[model samples]
Target: MAERTRPRPAADGAARNWLGLPAALAFIALVLLVDLAAAAHAVLIGFLALAPLLAAAVDTPRRTAAAAATATLAAVVAGLPSQTLGSLDHLLRVAVVIAVSIAAMYVARARTGREERIRRMTEIVRVTQRAILRDVPERVGGVTLRARYVSAYQEAGVGGDLYEVVPGPDRLRIIIGDVCGKGLPAVQLAAAVIGAFRQSAIVRTRLEEVAADLDALVAREPASTHGVTFVTAVLLEIRGPRLRVMSCGHPRPLLCRAGGSLVPLGTGTPKRPLGLGGDRGRPDTHRWDPGDRLLLYTDGMIEARDAAGRFFPVQRLARALSADSPEEALDAVWEAVRRHAGGPPRDDVALLLLQRLTPEPDTGGCGGPCPG
Candidate 1:
């Protein structure tokens, strides 16, 4: 059997040292003085007298009832001792006050219970979302990885923006993209993109093919039968000494080299956003020198506006990345964006950073027909 649970005190016990008993006692004394004369209006006096008891009852219902009973007994003994009519009138007035106090306590208790239930439900939803979008691992292939996502609203998890890294046949493939809108509909589109990328990244050797696969998946969804979501994405493949990139209407990613120089990728022109057509523009490729870092992000970072209404320039972000580690670079970029936005962001932001590690020296080649 579930153990019987008593209703807990509504207020902190230590904070209310004497439990507000003194205030209840003073209110009762005032009511008694008003009742002593037959000219006193008991109805109006009873309403005013019950106010303190009702407040106390919200915190300590039992104590409130005790105070009400004691006040009523003392008033009858001192104020109505000489008249039978006065004694009956005082009894009726005290009864009404106690009834009102109990009713107020019940309402307060019900509201508190409802709020607690809602809080618990919200916590469960947050946990489920984290399980779906776990943080990017610290290391992928021969590169160190770090990433961060901040939702526009408090307690929100994994909105329309997304990022993922997958170990591929010849390289580590990375993706960072944003769905068209916000809220649940956008979240659904984001999940679809993440799921499609995970499968395509492993099978498709080229970054362009991986991007095309994602676009096909989103366009075929039943919800897309009428209208399509425009997803801006960048697919990256990091090989031993080479980096290939495919852009789909996404913001240009930044590259920070070992010697502390910043360069923006896909600078000249960019491809159209995904989910609208089947044709993809040409992919860009570059050599990955030792200690090079790649930074991919959603538009929320650059579009953030400061107090003077100036947008956070991508050039400034690239400069900051050159001197900072992957983790520090992520933090600096987010701080700059937040300061630009004044407070909390009004849109979802996602970022992914990858640092090329020094390649391990080759020892010996594996023999043909090795044991499976």
Candidate 2:
């Protein structure tokens, strides 16, 4: 079944687009009436040139042209009683109106063309994001999984952050990483890392080998323009009751136990971030007990700052995950993070919540009761 994601409202609504034309027409009417009322002494008709320019900034090119025509006609009408048609001064005012309208039309065309190109590129970014950062399934290897990716760039819905879940016969391997930068190059590097993770996870039996493969891929990938490309990642392999973790210069995963204890897993100093040519060494082992929840996230979560420049409190995560379901838990944390930052995160954030479900007694199936 498809995940029921919320629909986002349009950034620029249709009603907003319609405002520019009506506003331009109203301005033209006001200026025409004032020019007539001034008894031809104060020539405000030339000021009608502002109408089309205003429309060109916010309205469609066709509407901008209409605004230009309306302004020129208004100028002609205002010039009638004063110069009485065909007069040099009256013709000069009309000529000025015409000249300004032509310039406005040119501006409208150029602005409209640039907007169209941006629209096309935004569509391309959406398609690429969908392909590269496909949604994670609801469940994987007997564990309920909930994932969310938030990009700082609203135009490009996805950025340098990435996460993936690769399921084996008895185990589940997961990776969450962040590339060094942003934009298309960052997205390309993120895609490469995810690709390498999926491939290495399948072939390599050990988590260290998988991390090594990713390190090699990021180190040699030509997409790195700065040449010092690095990716901070956390790799996990969960089989039976054992959970092994290897952190490469990434935040430690938080484990919320059934008894309400929060533990930060892994030990020793974290290995250097991938692309630094350092050995990944070995993964640390931990217990994956039933009714336990594991929270894996990027640095964006803890690094998010508020108006006072204070970082988000990491301890609040355990309370946030106390919701009834994994999905709701993720939503709670996401909302809290946004609230703490006072807006969207300044950097890309990727979160994965994995809950170990207690097995059913009757059929011994993974579909078991969830802990609060």
Candidate 3:
């Protein structure tokens, strides 16, 4: 059963505990030797109690208490060789060692508790964020669709990156973007941008209007007061075989034609990222034939770094996709990124791919495919 097969890492902790008491006693013995050699009258080497204090950080409280007891007993025995056990001074040295160990144990426990609470909170936040960024659909406006997201750290499973697709009988609209920062505030801002897109995508006649509306929504939010952070966004609208794109300080998307040629799209001069008041530019249009694919992504995908500090080559990889469908292409791209990074990412990545599917057979009187 899966339950029986799960690994238990805690089993190793007990093995490590075996090393704790002896190490503490050895440290105390060394200090006693130094005291004897120097012939100091005062317990000048009592500072060596720090060894047990450090042990408290890794060992359980019970184990740490045992180490502290061993250390304190050793210190007392060492002092008895030089001073009488009945002397009040000898008791003071022993108490100092015990006090240091107890304080360390309590502080360590408090810190561990705080860390656990934070980890649990992070998990709850990641779950909510995933629900917000979940996939839109498998097919949209005669196109097969795929989307993927990767968070920068495994501890914090999601960040400011966002993506969405709204399918309609006559038009398909998609948005991919990255907020200026991470944390709950950035996620709230990303959600606001998606909400604006959902509300205006169908009603607005032009991509320019949608962009302006999104900018207005972000500009009016409380998060906009800082003025430094902005959302880099690209909006795409496709009506039948015609595709239009409007970029707002976001990276340009790539288009893979049906004929096996790949090219990055051009949306003219870049505008300011959303949140700063600026003019919204017009959208560039393209003709999308069946079998053509469009790739939309945030900077996180292109900016991922390897151990050598080189950035991932998004365009070069775009030209390399030879998958049979959009889903397979997205998987290949994700796998390539994982291999390049070699571990958890340093930034959140959001990707969306749309491939136009072949049209249905024509049953018109003209014996040809119907025009949009």
For each candidate in the order shown, give its overall lDDT on alpha carbons: 0.68, 0.82, 0.73
- For model 2, how does the per-residue alpha-carbon lDDT over 282-348 read when each residue is reduced to its tens digit? 7887776778899999999999999999998988777888778888888889999999999878888
Best by lDDT: 2
Root-mean-square deviation (CA) per prediction? 9.2, 4.6, 6.6
Could you give candidate 1's per-residue lDDT for residues 213-266 as a string of tens digits? 888887876666777677899888766666667788899888877776777776
User: Which lDDT tens digits does candidate 3 get at residues 115-154?
Assistant: 6797688768766766677656887547788777776754
Candidate 1 vs candidate 3, lDDT winner: 3
Sort the predicted structures by lDDT, highest score first. Answer: 2, 3, 1
Native-to-model Cα distance after best TM-score fit, residue 213 in candidate 2, in Å: 1.3
Worst ten-residue run, lDDT, model 1?
1-10
Q: Which ten residues in a row have the lowest lDDT in candidate 2?
A: 363-372
Q: For model 1, what is the alpha-carbon lDDT of residue 169?
A: 57
Winner by lDDT between candidate 3 and candidate 2: 2
Candidate 2 similarity to native, TM-score: 0.88
Instruction: List where candidate 2 sits over 4 angstroms from the true fold.
Output: 1-9, 36-42, 80-86, 223-227, 259-261, 360-372
Clash count, candidate 3: 0
Clash number for model 2? 0
